[model samples]
Target: MEKERKVFGISWNVFLLGLVSFLNDMSSEMIAPIVPAYLTEVLKVGKLAGGSIMGLIESASSLFKVVFGYFSDRFRKRKVFVFTGYALSTVAKGALAFTQGWLDFLALRLLDRTGKGIRTAPRDALIAESSNGKTGKSFGFHRMMDTLGAVAGPLIAVLLLGLLSYLPKEVLYRRIFLISAVPGIISLIIIALFVKDRGGEVKKKIAGVSSLRSRSLQLFLAVVALGTLGRYSYAFTLWKAEELGYTVLQGSAFYALFNLIYALSAYPIGVYSDRVSKKALIGAGFLLSALASICFAFAQSLPLLVVAFILYGLHMAVMDTVPRAYMAELAGEGEKGTVIGAYHTVVGVFAFPASLIAGYLWNTYSLTYSFLFASAMAFLAFILLQFD
Candidate 1:
């Protein structure tokens, strides 16, 4: 009898990439939970300005995702862009300690997200190429580790705050920002030392990203764009928690809960996606997103907010992992990077107005209107995907 090759169902390189992501998220998440408060309280920025900053950051990320993704495919280079991206982010994270105003915050924040946009599609292409038939399994495993880091990042923040309670808040915040560089540096070393340039495996298609001309990609990107149009910044979630009377520490706890459930469920659902239909999983994700919107819309208490967070994590697991895998499966040879980049860029472009719209709704109508709008969009997306 032949022995089956089974070890997390990913290449050794993919596994190392996952480790890199895990460390990076750990560094990033350490900053994420504190961003809203840091901007509004310490920097004296308003909530609307904060939301706008997030919107610009999202836009920056999208812009870079398409730009670098195409070039990576055009030049048939992956590791170099991936390395530069992470290195830039490491510098940006460390630079946070020196930010003087909202302008500084905006510039540094955009720089950080730019790095993300550059690395994401190429890294995902690398994983998709590596995952083969077990696309979900590979993505699930990566996200599981990424989410695990997310779980730790906020908790680490809370712990650091508690331990350093005696220090001035400004000093403490700067210290945490400085500390984020450690994990980021570790990630850079791993990528530099271990991750190889596997771009040679991909055949260079015609010179540009004409691969997006395919009808299937057109439909997929449209549906996802429409579906994700309402999915706004998760910073809104933390904002909502604060509105509901949870302290910053408690909000971190809620975020941690969300990541915990996400980490635990991501891999199992990813493995299950391999056995079932990817479209079905994607559709289910849309509906779950709708459901979570409703829950967040109606949630009145912290405990109820916890329920919303849990559903939110589940929605991410079902939707986020499957669609990319599906798209990767759909791509022609050597086109994964471009297609994935275009797909992400499209969804992100549509999502550009999300936080702005959410902020507008919150300021003009109410949070309820924002949530309802999101729920309606998600439901519509799910219905459309079902038709596909």
Candidate 2:
């Protein structure tokens, strides 16, 4: 495998695509850390509805990613889908400036995620194709760039809000949304100019029912679904910060910190996964994540909560890079995009219900209970992987 596979190397396409993701994540995270606050405080959507909305958008993206990726595989075209998806996200962010109600917000969220769904698999496919055989390093580099953007977006948001805003609360958020468009434009240009697709002749036929049949992939998807149930979101971390009386600026700062750590760890963890068992790393990630969630739940002071958030970032670094690499490893060569899309779709299918359950538990019971529930789900995912 080592001789046949390139090691510690990547191509120009990979670097360019990573820049595209970097810019896109910068645009996306600019708004993400603040969306819950905007929905809850401005739109008055309530916690459960907000969680449901967030989860629904995510699930919707996964659905589209799967569908588009399947078609892209059949058609052997990836660039158009990638371009169109980023365009859609850019439009969505533009619309956020004028959104006045929950309906508009919902529409914008769906549209934004629609772009995500369309682009994710193709973008990933492009990276994998570029690397040929070093799947771990390829995906890891992409994730690192993506998380670097994640770190920058919040910092940008914080800076803009701090320096340029003296307006009312609503206006301030609107201005932040407007500024998000800058990264979107940057991403569009970077992708259009630099990203390339070299995957050979596409089959041009829909996968028959048999193409979707992979028992190992199915088992892994189930495990991932269970893991996602325990993984509510980092948004909740911001929410908890607010509950602890952290200002929005403070929350954004923490958000940036988390992403910083997450960005730094992505490549190392990916490389490490190649050295060890991917499943073992995933289990370790989940277990550490559970501990972080539990700690977040019981934390009463700002310092402890900050610690939990930092650890949560580490958890994400492991989760985001390794599992996808594992999935790629599990997939047959030509079937990578299909497998990636299917994996995301399956986990996303579970995300909808998981968010609903977590929201209900958070609202009806307590936030602590919600964290505990998330922790339990992580443990379950860890346990299920033993058989794999």
Candidate 3:
């Protein structure tokens, strides 16, 4: 038997996967913080339309996860899907520089998300396979590395915007979008050279969705579905900053701060999740999300908004990291990818209506109403979790 390599006490595959996510997230976040402003201010789209677009884009990205995940498991090949997904996203993101209208932008964004949907479940299955029983620790470390890119990406955008202050806003944003593709390209190279496929073992029958009979997983899925309805796009947070009179550069800085907190907290939370109850941690995260939404609803100043973003970051860390470990643990060995894909699909499907409802509330009513709706849903999710 060949000896497996370890990095930072986790499998080499896990560490490399984290590095891939770090670079990819850096590429994605560089453009993410500014996208809402670009759509609303530059493209002259309405807030409701912008919100719907973002939600649609996000949901589209995850909708394909289940199909691709099943294919990966069925063929017992993980690396091919992973590589193809990254490649598609890289092309889509780079093509953003050429889009002149919202329709074209939406097309490219969908392609990018399709890539994400293709890769997510299989990549997560890779992480689970590589964890060697340290599921929580592995996922947590991956989240930490991934978020560090999230932290760096916005700061980089801030710096670029400052440097290109003399250019027209449209040109500057386009240039940043072009430059963002570099990290993604680098990630692809790493994936091609380093990421290994561990799904070579022959199984007599690959498990399908019907095999996901675990009661705990079903309850977890329901809780995630309910919670997702309240989880609006991050654009709303940036929009709130704009409403409070902060510049885009300042908003990016604030986003970087949120990612910093998430990065710092994720690993410890992941490690603790191994020792404690993942359900309780996820419930606590939901509660924090509810409180954060309430704060966003009432925040009138930058400081209050900062506090809200901090809480949001903490909750994101828990919701994003612990759930993967929990789901991996819940799944049987032959069905990890399918089960995780199902979980992601549920979140994605619910996110569509969630974002639409949030947009309606923000458009027809007020931002406060939208946030209050989010808080109410999150609180309900937290309460429902108790039944599990």
Candidate 4:
């Protein structure tokens, strides 16, 4: 792969996108942990309802990413969708402070996710376009910044909540959520100032679906979807840790450590990817995820859990960023948004079922079974991607 030269080996756009994600994540994380508490403790909803609401939000986010992605490509406009997505999420941050019930919160959550859905594909394509030859490093840098924000978000929430302890607990929670608006606004400013508006150029409008259905893209997406089917959310890892005699404090610390490991690894991995083969790195990522999942399944000691989580971070660092870089490489010029959108759409469509299967296996048999199944599927993806 040829490394596209950029100012400082990465364009200003990469920095801007990374910064935008950092701020957005920090804002989102500040409020995410409190949502369940507000729903159950304040609104009197059951646990099942809260979980279902989150599921809905995830699905909507994924679906909208596809929808907005198609439009982004169809119209050849990226910045406007990106701008709108951030704006909605920014508005949602403020709304979270004022929600009266679970349903209200659900609406805000969906709206927030809708913003995410709109921005993801086009933003990714924009990043890829800016860093033509060095997708790995650029995307890696972006992920690193984003993960750093994820790590910081929870800490900010804690600090803010602590500072507002004089207020009633419920009021304090709302206050904490309200503070998220600051970062949201800042990110929007950054977006307005730094993000370029790459409106579409005139070209023969091919069917977006047909463009996305090239034999190679189809095969790649199939492999990716199969791998994603095995891949469920990270909450199970925390559950596994708690089950293994770890306290909530330990589990929380472990998650922060995992994010730290993920952030630290991404840029270096991207640099290495450019020097070597992205496919091999992607395959290695799945295998690493398999290894990490197995570690989660059998963690008995703190040391083992640490290793598992670190490897888990590594798996994501590789799997998450490298594949996008590869996708950018694989997508045709005008079809980047559509092809990427289709890829995520497949994963979103299958995610609920994947989670359901994982939950069922964990509930019915053993958590080990779920992890093993995921490992096998990821390994299979790695193998299949090689042929691609």
Question: Relative to the true structure, how large is the alpha-carbon lDDT of every model?
Answer: 0.83, 0.81, 0.89, 0.77
- Ranked candidates, highest lDDT first: 3, 1, 2, 4
lDDT of 2: 0.81
Model 1 regions lying over 4 Å from their true place: 1-7, 203-211
Q: Please, what are the lDDT tens digits per residue for candidate 3 over residues 207-244?
A: 45654776867877888999999998888888888888
lDDT for model 3: 0.89
- What are the runs in model 3 whose C-alpha is more than 4 Å off? 202-205
Error of 4 at 244 (Å): 4.7
Q: Per-residue lDDT for 111-191 in model 1, tens only?
A: 998898999889988887666568889988988888888988989988988898798888888899999989999999999
TM-score of 3: 0.98
Question: Could you arrange the candidates by TM-score from highest to lowest?
Answer: 3, 1, 2, 4
Q: Report RMSD for candidate 3.
A: 1.2
CA deviation > 4 Å runs, candidate 2: 1-8, 201-212
Clashes of each: 0, 0, 0, 2
Error of 2 at 292 (Å): 1.6
TM-score of each candidate structure, all chains considered together: 0.95, 0.94, 0.98, 0.87
